[model samples]
Structures are given as C-alpha cells and as structure tokens.
Target: MHLISQLCFLLCAAALGNAVVLRPRDPVKYQLKTPPLDTPWTDKVGRSPWPQYPRPQLRRDVWNSLNGIWTYQAAAGAGDVEKSPPLLPYAEEVLIPSCIEGGISGLQKWGVTHMWFGTYFEIPQEWNSNERILLNFEAVDYEATVFVNNVRLGRNTGGYFRFTFDITDQVKRGQLNSLKVFVFDPTDDQSIPQGKQTKRLSHIFYTPCSGIWQTVWLESVPKNHITSVDISGGMDGQLNITVHSNTRQPTQVKVEIHGLESEYATQRWGFESDQLAKISVPGVKLWSPDSPKLYNITVKMGDDLVQTYTGFRTIKSEVVNGVRRPILNGKFLFQFGPLDQGYWPDGIHLPPTHEAMVWDLELIKGLGMNMVRKHIKIEPDLFYEACDRLGLLVIQDMVSMRVHTNARPSDAEQAEFERQLEIMVNEHKSYPSIVTWVIYNEGWGQRTDYFPEFKIVDRIRVLDPSRLIDAVTGWEDHGTGDFLDNHHYADPQCGTPYYSRLSSPYDQSRIGFQGEFGGLGHRPEDKHLWPVEGAVRTINETYEIHANTDSYNWRAHVLLDLLKQQIERYACSGAVYTQTTDVEGEVNGLVTYDRRFVRVDTQQWRTDIQALYSAAAGRA
Candidate 1:
C-alpha cells in the first residue's frame, strides 16, 4: 500500500513538470519578534501555518495550502491607488492568516489600514489540464484585491466570508507564479459586519484586526466539476443532498456512505445539471451531544472526487407539556451553554492551529454543555465541524455592523448586509451542529423602518428552513423568528423580572431563550495570566464587583445559581452564558484568555450544568 501510494505520488509529480517547486512547504522563513499570548501551537506556526486543509467539507486530494511567510508592506491611503506591481522584495515578512495587529504575524503594528501581501507559488503542470485554477481566500478583512503575475483578477469586499477567483489564464504553467493581494479595512468607518472590532478598543469591543486573518489556498478543478454540495439529514432516515455544479454536460453523482456498522453502501444518480440527489439510510444514527455519529461520504462526478461528512439530526421548536422547548432529534433538549465569542488570545479571530480550535469545543462539551451561542462573529468552517463531531449545538450569529446613528442605513449598506447574510446561510447551512441562526444580537445594527428585522428573518427562512432563527436577540422583540431571546447580567433576581416585563405576550409557537446572561467576571490566578498591553488589571474593576471580592467563587456560584433560577422561575427553554473564555479587557469568561486556566471547578460545574437536563426533562 505504501509503495502504491509512492508510485501514485511519483506519477502525479511526473505529470506536473514542476515537481520539486510544487512542494507544500514554502522555503521563506518568518520569526515572530514579539509573540502574543503563545499557545502550544504558536511556535509551530512558522513552518506549518494552518497546515490542515482550509475547506473541510469539500475535500480534494490535489491542492496547495498558501499559508506561510508572505512579503508584506503597510501601504498609504485606503488602497485607492496601485502603488506597485505584483513583483516584490517586500518591506517586511509576516505570517499568512494572522492579521498585522496580531503579534504572531511579526508585524504587530495597529495603524496599518491598507497593506500589500505578495507571494510566489508554483502551479503543478498537471493542473494545467484542468480548465480552471481557483485561488481561494478563507477570509480577508473589509476589502481585498488580487493580482496574479501583476494581472488583476478581481476585488472582494466583506471581511468575514470566503471568496474565490479563477486564475487559470494569468498563471505561468510550470514556473513560479507571483500572487499579490491588497487589503483595506476601514474597521469602524464602514457599516460592514465588523463584529466587535473597533479602532478605539474598550469595553466589549477589542483591537481592530486588518488584512487577511484566515487561510489562503489554490486548487485545480476540471471544466465541469462540483462547485458545492449542501447536505441535510432527515428525520425519516434519509439524506437530502444537493450537488451544485458548474457544468453543462450530463453527470452522474456517485455517493458512498460509510458508518461504523454499515459498509460502503454505493448509490448512483444521473442528472442533466445541478440537481438534488436523495440517498436513504435504513437505520440512520442520530447525532447528539452524548453521541456524535458522523457518516463519511465520498461524492464522485466525472473527474471530480470530493470527500465530505454529515451527521443525521433535526431541530424544531415544539411544545413540550406547556412550554415550547427546542426538540433535537425528537427529544426536548434544553440547550444550555456559554456564548462563545470565538476569539483566540494568540490569533484573535483565527486559532493558533486546528487542534486549538477543537480544544475549545472539547472543553465546552466536557463542561456538560450541549449548546453554544456563537456571539456576533462568524468563525471558520472548522469551528462548526468540531461542534458537529463533538456533538455540541451552535447558534451561529450574523456578524453585526457598527451602528453610529439613529437614522436608517443607506440602501447600499442594507443591500450589502443582506448579501452577507445570504452568503453566511448558504456557506454554512450544511453543518448539522448549527441548529439555530441568530440574525440580530441585541439590536446592534437593527433598523425596523427601512430594513425591518422581520424581513431579514423571512429572508433567512427562505434561504435555510432547516434551522431555527432568533431574529433579534436581547432588547427588541420584533414579534418574529422562532425564539424570544434576551440578554441579562449577574443578578438573575432582578434580570428575570426585567425580562418578563420587556417580553411580549407568550406565543406558544415560538420558544423563549435567555440568549446572553450570567456575565460573572472572574479573574484567573496570577500564574495563568498572559495579559495584553491594554488589558484591565482585574475583571472586578470593569464589573465593579469590589477589589476584595472573591471573584472566582462569586462567578462560579452566580453562574450555578442563575442556571437553576432561569430554568425554574423563567421556565426558559434555553440560555447562553456570557462567554466561553476571557477576551482582552472583558474578563467575564469561564476560562482565561490564554486557555491556560479554568477559573471554576470543572467537576462541580459539570455536575451543576448536567442537573439542568434533569430539571428541564422533569418540567416536560
């Protein structure tokens, strides 16, 4: 088998004349002058930066990861003028995927609003046989312009989502190819989905991150190939698969499902164009927080072969006894977990490594939590994959825009917001773990007059009907969406009553959820701290909990007591705690920012959290 694999690699290399040049590892070196909050994976980042394949769902064997040292220079203006060509002996070297503000990127300067990144890559000669060579960017903040061999490909706006371009015509066949990318992020200036990023970092908002913050890569695909595949599991032991292709010719989609007990069961379906293909599994294994069972699937269409996986599960808001409870796979499972901000101490928006991302999810699962509200930030696809595999529910929030004025947004801004919302749903709709989509969080950029919150909910429902929708979390209950979500802090006694008074009449159809609550700030022990430059000395100072307060004990006790109170008094179906981990100045996390310490007693916290399941089940 090893010999056969070697022979196959040799043949592929031979077919691609630039065998040695097309190596995965880049020769350029980068050293972080000032490391920021170093994790176990931080040191290994130089050689193998996010070595894992960027796209997990659509896996292809032949692809190159363009995530290593890249030549970078801080440019003037908002990238309005083309200062230089794609050719470069750049001013400085920075790590790809990590933004300039991050210490791991080597250029930790914050003033850089516009920058140029240049790198050279060798395209395998064999890849030329394919009609198109795709250059993919997992994410680039604000706006990004791509130049292939000094020839402009295109520009992509919106920082959070992924974008791709075809560079087949501009690339050199076997020689090294030059790739240049110019990025401009007007953090708070533009009404984009900036999440919680701001120039003046204080309170909830953290330091602004500019340029590319996710993986960049290249892939070669045939003229007629599978573009994307949307997979959703059914309650009736059937899988609904939609194969979207860029081909005009008739193609046959071959699907092979592999499970623990079931062997590779093959099925074929013929389609003239992009079509829906259904494959039934007699006894499908349902995925849950207890048992995360994923069915590996291999899809083949002509020369294109893609590897993917999907878990069988269904989510709905059903009345259990009198209260509307969230039903996961025919069970009224009260989703209780932390509001995960998805911010990393080392990499900010991006994780130090794939393992680091998985570790956070593992901790969430270990804490006996079944769900996580991904608070106001869109994470990489891998984050959702980890949740799916670990059997944790995710309430994916749409990155919010910075609303400065009371006036309604311009038409252009509203259009852009809708476009991003559509893209978010389309890109991540397949993830079974994403049980609910939280459209608006505490009315951050919500305007009911021009762009009604209800309209956005309607649009999201049209795009993805499989998952539940929280139209507006916290304050404004627009009388839309599947849940009446609210945010509260520390004192559950006063908070629950305030929530009740603010709440509209009970709608039996829609469930009630405390989307954000229990922000009991706890400062980690001194030894586990990796304090940033402007970070607060203690969380108590921010939350005004008094300097002498035993914060750790208070935080833990408050969380436990609130969890019980919310379940019993409010009769709430679900709740999301303030956060999973500390972020910058905001030290109200269950764990520290460096991920070195858990402030609360994990064994006891787990037991307390698990008690909610029993409590909720008894209510049903």
Candidate 2:
C-alpha cells in the first residue's frame, strides 16, 4: 500500500510536468549498424564474432572470442524486475557486441531501454578459484546496469573507455549463467557524452545510437593481476613501463622486452618501485606513418602472464631557426592524417571485427599520413594499442558529458565534466601513441568549463604533462594545449604562422594543427556507405523535387574533386582531411560508409599527401 501510494504520487508529479514519459517519437533518421549478414549482392562472409581481434591495434595470440547472438527482447518496462511478468517474444533479436538501435541487432527500431540478453556459457574450471573473473566492456553508451544471474552486480556510465568489474562472487564456471543489461541514453540531453547526435536529423547531424555497440565478454585472471600499465619513451630513447596490481603481494613480476633488450635495463621490485621497469633499444626507430615500426612487450605477474605491446616515441613543437613546427625524433616533422569517425556500417561506432579496426589504421598509414585527430570520442584500449603497435600518432579527445558555457561554474555539470575527463586521462595515460587531449567538443552544448580550459590545461599538466592539451577545438580558445586549431571546409586555409586569432601571448614552443579543414566531398558509394540516404540525398538530379543541383548537389565526382582541391590548397601543421570514411549524413569521405571502395586512387592519394606534408614541413 505504501509503495502503491508513492507510485501514484510520482505519476501525479509527472503529469504536473516534473517528469517526462519519453514517448517513442520516431527519429528523423536511423543509422544502420549491421545489415543482413548474408547480403544477396556481395561476397562478404557472414560470420559470428564479426570483429575477430580481441585487441585490434594490440595483437595477442591467446584470447577467447565472445561475439555472437545473445537471446534478446525489448521489455515494456523493467525487463528484469524480480516480480515483473515475463517479456513477450518480441519476435526480434539483437546481436551481441552491437547496439540495439543498429540493424545488425535485427531490431532496427528504437525507443525502449529494457533489453534482456541471455547466453549460456562455461569457463574452464581451472580459470576460476585461484583466478579472478573480470567482465570487460569495450563500450556501452550512457548507462549500462549489469546483472549476473538474478543478482544485481554493478553499473557503469562512460561510453568510450574500457571498464572492468569483478564478477567472481556471482559467476560460476562450467554452468549456465544469465547476464542481463539495461541501458538508458538521454542523447545530447546535456547528460551524457552524445557527440553530435540529435533526435531531429537534419543539416549535418544525424540519429543517436543507444545501447551497446562494442564488445562484451569475460576473462579470467589470477588474483595478482596487473590492473594498469603506463608506458612512455623518454629523451634517452628508453621505454618505461609501470604496472599496478590488485594486491602488493611482494610478487616478483618477470619482464620481457621485445626489442633490443640491452638498450633497456629492467629491475623488478614489488609495490615499492611501484614495480617500475625500463628497457632501452638503441637506434630505435620512432613510430611514424611513412616508416611504420613497432615493438612487442609481455609481462608476467606472479604465476599469471599477459602479453601486450608498446612503442617508444616522442612528439613536441618548438621554434626552429625562426620557424615553429612539430618535431618527432629531433626532426622538424609534419603531421598529416584524417578525422577518423571510427564508425562502420557493420558496427556503427563499433567496428564489425578486430580486423575491421586494423583495416582503418592500416589504410590511413597506406595513405602516407601519420596522425589522426580522433575527433570527440574515446576508443577502446585496443584501438590505442593498435596505434601504439602500428606506429600511428593519436590526439585523443576526452568524452564530453555536458554543454560548455562561458558563465561561472555553478552547475554540477562542470564537476561531472571534470570527473569524466580525469577518468579518461587516468585510464589512457599509459599509451605511447596518444600525444594530445582535446577538451570541449565543437562548442556543441558547452556550459562552463568545469575547470577553465586553461586551468584544465594546468590540471592535465599535473596529471600526465608529457603530452599537449587543446582545451577547446576551433572556437573559444583559452590558449590551452600546445597548438592553434582551425576548421574550414571545401578549401584550404592556415592560421597565422606566428599569432593566430585565437593565440594571445602564445608561445612558439607549440605550433598549430590544421586540426580540422577539408570536407572534401568524395563518395566511395555502395560498399562503405553509412546509409544510402546520406549518400544519395538526391540521386542524378531527377529523383525528387528537392534535387536541385545548386541546392541539394551531393553528386559523387564533384565532391571528390572539391576535396582534391582543398588538400592541395591548404598548408598547416598537419592536415586532418574531413574524414577517413562517411558517417550517417556526412558523405564526405575518402572511402564509402561500408568500408569497401577507396573513392580515390590509393597510390595517387599517397603521393599527393606525402608531397603536401613535405611542403608543410619545409615551411614549418
């Protein structure tokens, strides 16, 4: 009776306008994450575990695959309430490691969050007992309330970084156990890290992806597991590694260095050294797209062993002979690459397979570019691992949780923003590939900087000061990070070499990153399309009345040529072309949405890219 009265009162308050029921209003657009596995028109193999690599960038030989169908259904409400009635058949299914809003899940429509997914599986008995059970979630947008069996386990909110929760208490080996997840995303509601997603898909933005769109799996690790790893290569050219564990245990962890071992000297000490280890490789070749080189690393903690990899590299900017430019390995170098959406038709933001992730990086390198401004999103560690292994430089962006503002910080939103920012930096500080941190995203829904952009810059300095920080990209520059940034479209442009409009009291120690410039209008068409609609807004000029060439003109070749002209026109620190591939409504890509065809000739594009880079470096 007490509960019933409270429920009634809550409904009354909702009717009075304090709450919203969130009726299922149709989205103006929908992104198709997974199409039919067996497309009637293609030679693609339809297989479970679409992305096969456990770590796309960081390859490992021993790992289990956990991508396949998990019994799923949309609940009317409270899908797993202890006393709630069972959910109806749903007649629908969602693929594991895929978002509910995605086509790959077999449930293309949206609006509900109570998704019940169940799978029966077993782990070797040996994996339990002495070892701990860790459930790793690559990403689950907004909110992921997890359950093991009928017990409520735990929950996580961040959508970009990797998270692990111990389930040893609830999980049983060689037995059938149920795993349930509930997700809620108020996309662009100023509550979550909903970058550029809108309910009303118009202009350049498109629909939002709700539930899980990344890998979900389980791994067994010994009680004395390496919880975190921090990697860095200093001026001495020695690779440094610091490993943190769950328990001190005074464990003698064995270290295996892949490259020239003599160059690096290793000493093992328990919690005392914080268990720090260093290795040197003389004549070490730094990671660069043109001369891609990588090294491997394996660590053994107690009786447990884990294999991973890292690179030894450094990036900085300074005035050289009266010119400012980015430097790598003591040479005035130019950084050029793409704005990788990191999304795919098969997986939306989630790559279809591990191979899929590798393909994007490899292709970027093949294009003769070295850096990728990983635009407004954080990727799984494996993505960073890949960048580290394949010798790619990345400017990582912290996930934005609130709109930015110039007003004083009165709202908790600022605190929340800083909270997530710190978490991101803490988790990813170890990677050698990441060199910069991008704070506010496009001024999207900015309110107030939790810490002013510059203050936050100082905070990052205290946290992991080795890299640079760009407080805000393209606008509201508070002189943070180490670069001047600008955004242009369909053409080339550069900030003033000495003092950009945003740079006041700017030091020459840092230069500018073309950051964003070039919406080259190229379409690879069919294979790599985000969706046919975004690609064919108005086909051939005769499809619809809105198809006027002057207004709705997005024909293929015209866009590609425009991109070519833009790339040739601009000279900046490094040019991040509009993008690596097409996203939902943004058909400007070197490749189509489906990850198939290269709209531009690979060799020609590479030559042009290298030439422009050479020219830019010369000027710098």
Best by lDDT: 1
lDDT of 2: 0.60
Per-prediction TM-score to the true structure, in the order listed: 0.90, 0.79
Q: Model 2, residue 76: what's the lDDT?
A: 58
TM-score of 1: 0.90
Model 2 segments more than 4 A misplaced? 1-47, 50-63, 76-91, 126-128, 248-250, 261-283, 401-410, 448-451, 497-509, 522-571, 601-604, 617-620
Backbone steric clashes in candidate 2, count = 27
lDDT of 1 by residue, 210-257 (tens): 888999999988878888888898676678888878764557777777
lDDT by residue (507-603, candidate 2, tens digit) is 3445645566555454343444454463356222211222222332343234334434433343245556777876665655666566655655666
